[model samples]
Target chain A: MEWFGANSFNFEFVSSVLQINNIQKSYGSVRALNGVSLQVPEGSVYGILGPNGSGKTTLLGILMSVLRAQHGSFDWFDGRYGDGYRKKIGCLLETPNFYQYLSGEENLRITVSISERGDEADIERVLKLVGLYERRKHRFATYSLGMKQRLAIGAALLGNPGVLVLDEPTNGLDPVGIAEIRDLIRSLRQAGHTIVIASHLLDEVEKVCTHVAILKKGNVLTDGPVTDVLMDEDVVELDATDREGLRSFLLTQSLTLETDKETGWIRLRFPKGQAKLEELNRTCMQQGIALTHLSLRRKKLETRFFELTND
Target chain B: MKIAPLLYTEWLKVRRYWAFWGIFALVLIAYPGISYLFYTGYQDIRSSNNKMDAMLKLMVGSPFGFPEVWHTLAYIASFLVFIPGVLVIMLITNEYQYRTQRQNILDGWKRDEFLWAKFWVVAALSILLTIVYALVVLVTGFVNPDMALAGIEVKSYYIGLFALITFNQLTIAFLFGFLLKRALLALGFFLFYFLIPENILIQLSRWRWHTGNWYHYLPMEASDRLIPPPPYLGEITNPADYKQMLQAIPEHILISVAYTGLFWLFCFWWLRRRDLT
Candidate 1:
């Protein structure tokens, strides 16, 4: 339960940073979102995990007001935000949609104007935060894809918005660029900004996101702490002295186990906190199968993700 | 007031844009520069002794000298419609092309603010173009030998109409830019609308449809009528005829006003109705 920061810390006094009601969106015949609702507590790095066209981008678009949802509504900071809510929320949607001809600094100046914040100091600070201060003078079009994405992060950091919404922040980036952005998001979360990231890369979410919602085909299959959901299964690797007897015993038992003949291991999963090593051995002894090798193996989110999404 | 930052945002977008500076330079030169050339040419012709030259000098007597200065400046400035049209198209269409329109709204701008940013740019361009023409008129009058301070008229109404016509033309460009959202397509339609469509439609209204005087009320033609062709070539030199030619007809002015309002209505509607996808 402590996998999410919510359990470790008392957030009762800290209001919900984002509350999405039963929001829905459609594009022609395709339903991009179908009455999706979620609440994001303050100071959480919430990752939205889904395959492409699973309504992740569409959801972010509706939240940012870039695209109107056909049904339902969402509120920011428990309805504390009004017309000026955008000044407190920074978003990078899909691409680094900056003016190609203008320098990064000039583009941020436009952002400053739109946000109506008078702090010119934050421009340099945000640029430095994204490691783009050196290239702030370069035209956006001249920069590589990684540099463009960095500048976009810098733009979103302007005015010190309380929340950041990023859609596929690592899209089209090299490994190093993805890591840089990942580190940036981690630091921003450490600094107490409520960050929301929509991504399909499972490992990226597992590494950085404290909470996650798995979406498939415009519907959220499940949502909770990443550790709580993905770690629901504890994999036990076992082999017995009577291999054929172990196989038949495993088949007769109510437990589900995946047997790999080449590795001479059958992997069985128990609910978290309920996988007792002695209990498993006792079951094998009663079946007249002596255990030769038994150990715990790391369970991968990739396996669980396929299991959940494929369903 | 709240629009200041929005204007600043728009200025940053276009301050370094090539089309911005290009059209700006073109308007600065085409208005005053052409006025200077016409003034010097009039002076040269006035000094000639040939019979045709003498008649021409009387016909175009000191195009920049007193009374004639205001009309001359406004007329030359009207030729600037196409340049600002192109500039306005670039300003509005660049948002769509770059996808900054979505970013701008996400940053805190209401959809109306996005439209106003472009509106203010058009308004500023019209005012600047009008003022440039005013300065050129004053300078042309100041340097002309036949210029008389006593006879000089500010012709504020004429200048106002000139600015209005410029706004009308720029709005036409804005409408097309919003409707098409493609620079080339918008510019092409802009060129065709102003250059060919108006003339052909007017001709058809006269020859084929035989609609008496109805063509002048058409949007582009109404703006064109705001600044009528300048009096040259020994035609309509009489005081009564000259005064009539110098002022825009009230009917045409009313039509231009209606079209200007309608143009903005369509632009705002487009901004509101369309998704910023």
Candidate 2:
């Protein structure tokens, strides 16, 4: 459901909420983040997608100031917010870190006091928002993994901050819990919060993220609008009686950016939304080639992620 | 940014924690109960025989009475300082075990703020335990059969010294917790260092050579020597040596204060530079 008004969609010139510049971090001999940089636009769901150990958490940790970077710097809200900038941003990094002995409500109270953003009254709103209102008085130790995660998100939402940084937010959630969190993130974005999510879940990122950065071994392989980074091109499977002729004719078309020969089919790629299967077939027929197989396949983010990291 | 909010935040974490209340309860019961036992034991020795009673009265004076009660209680209470030391270690290491230290910084606290928050907890707890020690002293002094309110003004400085010792010891405990980042490990190391190693070193230095006074300047040793034993033991043995040791109280206090400051400075520097995770 669209929680924000239509005017919120006007993105002609969106300012950046977080600007990371050339940050580098290392652990002994292993490099965790090597000169990584990105810009999270205001009121957008920015996703940092990568495989395990690809520095997704490291980069988020650096941005949140929990981990010190060996080199480079970052700015939140263009550094206009001063030292209290962190209070204006809600963050849940890595795991749900709360006092195990305290109840869910009590834990949020501590969070509110530390951030000094929301009052005790806001704690109930946040608990209800995360679906933990029913068990608000339950000790955090008694919470299931999903409940604990929900409480963490609830704590982050306590202040209604302008920016939210969530690292592997759906880590311990079940299917229903994951979907609920996904919707929560979408609704939060609709409410004008700029969310920066770090996740290896390609499907989740593709569904909710507006922008994405794919990382491989401490380096960002590609990043930008999701459509540009993950689905930059459309794929068409073309098989003809004469394979060489089909490949040769397809290469001459300006629409075809890449042509690959699979086992029994020829794969042709065109820029996103530039692929016209009927026109391609007609052009091939006009060249005296009758197509035996022709179909369009949308590039899945999972495939793109593997293709990027496998490099 | 202010210390009050940070302390309030820490109070929320421990207010419902059973371990915190458990240690506090132990102190309330044990501190006074142990002092009563010593008072009764001294009384029993004095009333046993006529000849021994005369000699004991000459040597012991009125230990549980007025001015001496404060010093006697401070020394006895120092032995139980490890109880609060254990609480400090548990509280700090629990943050590490749960990874809440990183969360605190992520929530809004600067690195130094987090360390300062913990230091405040250490200071607050020290002051609280010292208050309890003072209350026990007043009660013991008033209830003793040989109580005398005349010289009560003399040795009251022992209460302030007791507070300093508690603060220094707990600060050391905080350092151990920060370094180890594990509850069991920090507690184990603290107990080992406080109980076995430092004592062995101090005794070895004193008995094996003539340089025992040098070893009294160790972290816990300096604080322990602040109160020393009650005056009765000195009167029974070498009074001159005891007076000499008493003169060194200022040096021991300086060493204790320096160590406390050094530990906090080291923690602030280390925390600001190291990664929380």
Candidate 3:
């Protein structure tokens, strides 16, 4: 349950912030979502990861109640809030939707008024938080794509809602803007707000999300803590004059989970913290196969994602 | 939410929008401006020295005077309802254009709440139109030198009839904007329907098909009939025909109210059922 390592804060009791059940939707013969379900834990940054047309937006739309589900239901905060649950949840679905003629400050005012959560003072704080305080009076249509995206984040941050559901929060942002949003999300997590983000960027998800659900073709291929879903395994590569002998010898070892033969090396997979480079070198030499190359590397999430998606 | 906040939110949106203010300004000017022109033209005919002009004035009487001014202004102002009707369409379609309708629901508003807020706006605009009509009637009646205010109580209900006509027209515009979801398409189709199609259908029903009183019940036509053209013009040409037109004002009011309610209900149903995407 405690997926984060030593640096992570411990939650004495984890609760579900959002529980989605078998939500299905379609558009004129295209099945956008096929019974997709997932739960977002309280105080955790959850990522819904998928490629374009993989139903990430569709699922978020349904959960936000902007788009109706064909058959299924989702509960927020255990339905304790009734019809007022949305006020507790701030969401930015797909593109940054705002009145083009209204300034950023003016737009967030409407948002604040509708949510009935925050006030004019909170609006100032959020505008500054998203670094749009200076341009707050500028019309949304005049802002750059990055600025528009940031203003949207600023709007979502209003009222200081307990949960923030963002679709591609880092979209249209430059490298620095992306990093700033990541740090902001981390800071928000530290403040005990649960965040649900839908993104196709593996790097973004891997860096910021504690938990992720990988979706493909309207189906969830894998979902869990990032550490578990990515399969934390150490890969050891070995090359020897007698490749066949090294391969046979490594296949016999108990630490080797799987071995893959490459052009000039044999790749050995082992569970995390189980790869012993010195022992493998010594054993290979004793087996009369002198190793030419010996190295170890951890498997990347990108690799794991590709393996799961088979794309 | 409550009605005050709902209307306030709508005000926040349009307070800075020049298009909204521009259309509203046009309404304020044109509503009374056109009525004033008709009043002056009738005054000119009344003061003419020619025998025929004097005789014609006798037949028509003073349309700008007390009781007649209400009906006269209502008929003239109804022609300009399209000004505010365009405003309603633009406001509704702006949501679809910007996709803020979905964002409103996403932020916290129930789908019905968002729509009800707009319905209140329509109601407010209708009331404003009625007030303008009343002011025009009062100013025109009081300014006419030969007119007496004694008959002011007669046909005072035309003010409410004016409001119903505007409400029905605006609700129909709301339907167009909601269904089309695009400003140009909705406005174009609305104008085409209001200007040409509905008129043609009404004429065809009356002249070609000889459907008695059926044409009066058409959506916009029902409201149009609530305030028939200056009864004097009908009196001068055909007294019996014009007299027959006034008999159906009650029925026209009922049909107009029903159409307004039905249009609003249809919009509510569509908004609740269709995906805001």
Q: Top model by lDDT, which number?
A: 2
lDDT of model 3 at position B256: 90
lDDT of 2 by residue, A8-77 (tens): 3212233988889999999999998889988888888999988889999989888888889999899988
lDDT of every predicted structure (CA atoms): 0.80, 0.85, 0.85
Q: For each candidate, what's the DockQ?
A: 0.64, 0.72, 0.71
Clash number for each model: 0, 0, 0
Ranking of predictions according to lDDT: 2, 3, 1
In order of appearance, the predictions have TM-scores of 0.87, 0.89, 0.90
Better candidate number, 2 or 3, judged by DockQ: 2
- Cα-based lDDT at residue B111, candidate 2: 82
For candidate 3 chain B, which ten residues in a row score worst on lDDT?
B52-61
Model 2: per-residue Cα lDDT over B163-200, one tens digit each: 99999999999999999999899999998988998888
Off by over 4 Å in 2: A1-14, A234-268, A271-298, B49-52
Query: Who wins the DockQ comparison?
Result: 2
lDDT of 1: 0.80
lDDT of 3: 0.85
Which regions of candidate 3 fall more than 4 Å away from where they truly are? A1-14, A232-267, A271-298, B50-53
Candidate 3 pairs with clashing backbones: none
Give per-residue CA lDDT, model 1, range A1-311, as digits (tens). Answer: 01012212212234688889899888899999998988898888899988778889889888888788889999886666575677777888898888888998888888888876525787887778777889989888898888888888778877666688988888778897788778877877776778899988888887888888888888888887777777776778899877888988888877787876789688888878777888889988987889998886644667778888885
